[model samples]
Target: MKLLYLSYLNSFKGLSREVWWLALVTLINRAGTMVIPFLSLYLTQDRGFSLEDVGTIMSCFGLGSLAGTWLGGKLTDRIGYYKVMVWSLFLTGVLFIWLQMLESFYAICSGIFVLMVIADSFRPATYVAMSAYSKHENKTRSVTLIRLAINLGFSAGPAIGGVIIASVGYFGLFWIDGVTCLLAALLLLLVLNPKKAKELDQVKNEAPRSAYSDYPYLLFIGAMVLLGLIFVQYFSTVPLFYSEMRSLSEVGIGLLLAMNGFIIFVFEMPLIKYLETSTLSRTSLMIIGLAMTTFSFFFLTIGTWTGLLVIGMILMTLGEMITFPFSSAFAMDRSRSGRQGEYMALYNIAFSISHIFAHNGGMVSIANFGYKSTWYLAMIIGVMGILLLYALRYRLQTSRKK
Candidate 1:
């Protein structure tokens, strides 16, 4: 037990204090992530929204994410990461309070759109700050640390949210979520202090570089969008499966969802660290990750038992553990010094695209075609992602030789 515990500490050792603090910020921000994970359920059960209605509202969030990602990328480069992070965090929390009061479909949808725009704009700046603070060798691990904190918070959020809904209902979820967003921003302000952000290891001489012009990077982003389409099914459609098909209760579904985060928390860091000494190229690692992702849905398609659900969750999470952090690290490596934020923002746009596909397409598909059909789509998309990511290896290799 002591040996195991000591290894975990050794993994985190040597990353800067700023990196750890950033991870704390991620933890605080995600712990209140109650609104989205439970959104379909809240809309369907409480507000009596049809799947289509929920889909449309989510599409609004996706639209806002697209707009916000672009705007955030531009702003991160122009305004510096500190100001962008501060305002994005503060205003996003304020918007959530506004969102809680609105009732009409259009009103709520509009509110969600604006809220996502403000909230997601923080992402590029956050990436910029991470790149600024992280060392070259530890870049992927830095992203992983933040992801670890996020998953830990996610593990806690739904467990608590299940209670919040059982007692005070969805209203409590929103209020608490808003407070936590504010709390995360406050931590960033108190610890980093916007004025002293310059003390971080920023790229001192950055020439302007356009990410769009990089064809290899563009192809990589395209591959990620397809991968995300497969992945976001866990968020948008899987809950519906456990509810409608598997007959899991609300709390049961929350635990089922928490399984993803808990698995990542346990296995991902150690696995990444182990791969450091292996001969596999980063792209080879991504290929393996995508292959694992492709098969997870196929395995889920086999049966809906508790054992299968556990298996499916484990495969999907291991797939995510393998893909997301490494992909971000690759994007960071491909970026020109000053252009890292733009690259990360473009990479994140894949997420926005998947949100559109996941909510609008995933919901509508399941509503009409059935859950098995949805998993089939996930399987096919994952296959396509693997092929594209395979092609990406050569591009990256060629770039490396240049």
Candidate 2:
């Protein structure tokens, strides 16, 4: 037992204090994300809103996220990561508190829209700080560790949310989520104030800006937007699929999500080490992950057993483990120094846009083509993404030889 404890302590010996603080802050923030996965259910079931109304509200959030992504990146470059994060957290907490008090559909929609903007603004700032802090050797690991922290919180948050909702309902969940946000903000302010001299220098060295510019960056942003649309089905449709099949209880779904977190926490570090030696680039891993996620949906359509669902969830988690870090790392690598915040913000837009598309598309697809067909559609998108990556690989290889 002593040996085990010492081994665990030794494992974290090489991580910087900043990384540790960031990881802790992420955990605090994610613990509050218990509200996200179940937000749709809360709106429809408890708050007495229609599915269409829920979609409308979420779409509003997506729109806000679109603006927030650009704003976040720009702000991070101008004001620094610490400042942006502080305000983002404080505003997000206030918004969550406001959300708890809302009664009407319009009020809920408006409140959530504003909250999403504030909540999302922190994303690019956090990523920029992480990228700036990491060395090339440990960059992937650093990003993966951050992801691991998120998965850890994600693992617990929903299960806790389930119990809270069952016992005290949606308002309780909101209250807890708001309180955690404030705590996370405080932690960020106290513990993670890394230097930003390099970031400031990068901004000063950039060329004069054109209002009509940002086109090349926008192209990558567009691709990420499509990718987000394809990926959002996992959160929005997958659970609904399982629920419809009557294969898992609410607690069971929470457990499955927790399993995803555990897999990442336990395996991501070693997996990153192994992949580092492989010929595969970050883009290649993303393609592979997408393919696996697409394939998992097929299993979902065919099997209703708990065991099969678990297997499918494992595959999806594996895909997530591969794609998320690689995508973030690759996006950061492509970004210019001063523009890191904007690049990361663009990357986040993909997620927001995808969420809206998936919710709307999934509903239509499920109604018309059934759940199996919806999975097939996701498979098709995965294929397209793979093809795009392959084309990119060829272009890169050809250019290198020249």
Candidate 3:
């Protein structure tokens, strides 16, 4: 029986030791992301801030991420992934500790901006590491595994965070998050070193390509930005809608969000494999995903947690599972060997841009139009995403046939 168990482990052996280490590092880093899932609530409930203030603060984080994504990408190309990952992880840990000490709202907002910049800047390093470390045949699976690690951490973090917030308070959550980040940094510093470190200097000296030069890549990035705009509402407005508007408990809200992560964990891999062979192109999957996500919001307009709400959440997760990884894989496939960092960096930019719109515009929509109307607006955006994907599909197909 023990031999059988060991054999099972060896059968799924595409992940190298370095890749496993990176996954562990990702898990630890993401465990600290407990702060993000509940950040809006923390700002409003614990910190005694208004929704607008929360939106502004969150937008600052997004703005920082915008800069970080670009810088991290550029640096990854210049210095290689190892040094960038080590420093980024350590600096992000330091920022988290500093964030826990701030009492003033303005200070917290500023800290958030700086923290996001440092934290997000690490992503390109991580992705570049994954791209470099994994074999071509395993690339999609490797990226999915990395995301799986993140979602698994997310799954545990928020559920535990909710309990901690209810029992020991937000400071306890912050302390736990800080410790996890520190531990993650230490692990990365110890175990992983890029094999291509010697080539970094030569690569850095090479002329840079304009981000605009890759129009297809830019289109995909634009699609992701649109997706992020719609998706950010899950973090920003969904909790508010459930708690303030629909009158659900915090625990209930936490469970709903947890369900989202859990679904991703359970289905993402199998779904990815199934979709990999399907005639449905990446663009088509994205359109379907976005349409499902948009339609999911329609039930929210009714202000009831009927079976429809559960179904909507499932659809949203399914859409996400299809779109997000495929988008990343597509970008990586199109990128030049040395410019992987730049391509992934541009890809990460979508999330930051989305956060900016979602927090700022989403909050305003909720305040003025109420939860139902705001969902409708999100649905409209999702529809636009569908149209955008359809338009891009022809371009993608044409490129592939060449």
TM-score of each: 0.88, 0.84, 0.83
What is each predicted model's overall lDDT from 0 to 1? Answer: 0.81, 0.75, 0.77
Q: How much is 299 displaced in model 1, in angstroms?
A: 1.6
- Provide the lDDT at 293 for model 3: 77
lDDT of 1 by residue, 1-402 (tens): 898777776776667777888889888888877777788898889888898998788788789989898788888888878778878888877887777788889997989889888888888888888877877777788889988887788777888899999999998988888888898889899887756643345575446678888887787888899988888788768878878888989998878777776777877887777775588877888888888887888766786577888787788788889888888888877764437668878988888888776666887898899889888888888888888877788877887899
Candidate 3 minimal-lDDT segment of 10 residues: 196-205
Output the lDDT of residue 237, model 1: 81
**How does model 2 score by TM-score?**
0.84
lDDT of 2 by residue, 1-402 (tens): 786556545444455567767888988898887998899898888888988898788788788787777788889878878889889988888788788889998888788878888888888888877776666656677788888788778877988999999999888888888889999998887776554223221334355343125444454455455566566776777888777775678888878867876788767776776676688887788778877776777777674567888888888888877878787787666665336676777678677777657678887998999888888888887777667666666665676899
Q: Which stretches of candidate 3 lie over 4 Å from their true place?
A: 1-13, 36-56, 101-107, 159-175, 195-208, 242-252, 301-305, 370-372, 400-402
Q: Clashing residue pairs, candidate 2?
A: 73-341, 229-354
- Best prediction by lDDT: 1
Error of 1 at 356 (Å): 0.8
